[model samples]
Target: MTMKKLGFAGVMIVALVGLSLATQAQVKKGKTRPLTTKQMMAGLVKPQCAGLGEALKAAPSDDKAWEELATKAALLNESGYSLMDDGRCPDGVWASACKNLQTASAAVLAKIEAKDYAGAQAEFKGVTASCGECHKAHKK
Candidate 1:
């Protein structure tokens, strides 16, 4: 093929791949789905946060307790999804804080999975920091 033709084909392939990825991301997000703010707080965040606190206090070595901790961490991650829905982030501050929450949640999950309580404790502070930052800036 001519050099011009080859270059054009390459650009077209890159664009198609990018478009395919974007579409899959949208479809995947639709499946998981963000909850409304109230639903997130009542059903996901509040309960998960409280449960995580209790689990920390207990710190049982049993598999079930650890599993609960992991679940709470995963739910915390999911709760951030509620904040990140389209039209939910009214400003940059909220968007940034929500991103922090998601990052902290993932860190917490990894720490708990490794049975690293100290690390998890530190990461949980990040979660709380994100929460406080948002509330201070946005909440009434």
Candidate 2:
């Protein structure tokens, strides 16, 4: 009777472990599916761009503020690359816009690193313009 009970307990543990592994596998597969364009824009691009815009409103007075601006620019650059990743880019226009965004954000980051507020502001305009161009082509 003890042997039978142990056998049953062992089988239950194995079954539970298998179930947990299967659940985790499913979740990993789901994560591989890319975010929708809207999701990417709202989750990353928009917020990052907004942060850059707000930061550009005034020159950084200290190292912390400058670092914040640089962080936003880098995030915006990454978001631009993400826009084109995972087969999300639909056409040349989308590609062009994404490239423009990357270039602009890089420029903004460079200016921020140099502590050049005016240059950063100038480059930031290109970032916003790239967004507008893409929206004009695709947004409803």
Candidate 3:
């Protein structure tokens, strides 16, 4: 019943999906064709998250991997905001979770920027954990 009990990621996703009917009528994030939020989730968010995972698997000494992770983090950060835009979080915990996700993604970027491999790995895990938390609650 409560946001905490509901799981921020899951509740946020459900909230986003609940708004799909409204978004479906409009062009997807200013695309040529219309797309439901669910479609975007499948098309945009999922692959990008996978890319993030791949970046995480890269060797720490791999500069190219860190670069890829930075790029993926930026994209994922935007995707996170896009998932629940206009501050449409379901509740306080949901909002906090969303913010933490965004922040974690940024941390990923920052760690890569500083060439802090260990920090980047930890942040990558943090990002993954947030996604898992939400998916557990909402992903079908």
| TM-score leader | 2
| Residue lDDT tens for model 1, 48-128 | 987886777645588888888999999899877767774466567878888999999999999999988878877888888
Worst lDDT 10-window in candidate 3: 24-33
Off by over 4 Å in 3: 1-34, 60-64, 86-88
**Residue 78 Cα positional deviation in candidate 2, in Å, after optimal superposition:** 0.6
| Candidate lDDT (C-alpha), each | 0.77, 0.82, 0.69
Candidate 2 differs from the real structure by a C-alpha RMSD in angstroms, to one decimal, of 12.2
Best by lDDT: 2
Quote each prediction's TM-score.
Answer: 0.71, 0.75, 0.63
- Per residue, candidate 2 scores C-alpha lDDT tens digits across 1-140 of 45477698787887899877654443222225656667667878899899889878988999999999999999999988877665556568878998999999999999999999999999999999999988897675
The whole-model C-alpha lDDT of candidate 1 against the native structure comes to 0.77
Question: Which regions of candidate 1 fall more than 4 Å away from where they truly are?
Answer: 1-35
**lDDT by residue for model 3 over 48-91, one digit each (tens)?**
77877775665556777667777778887887776566433444
Query: Candidate 2 at 8: error in angstroms?
Result: 62
Model 1 per-residue lDDT at 110? 99
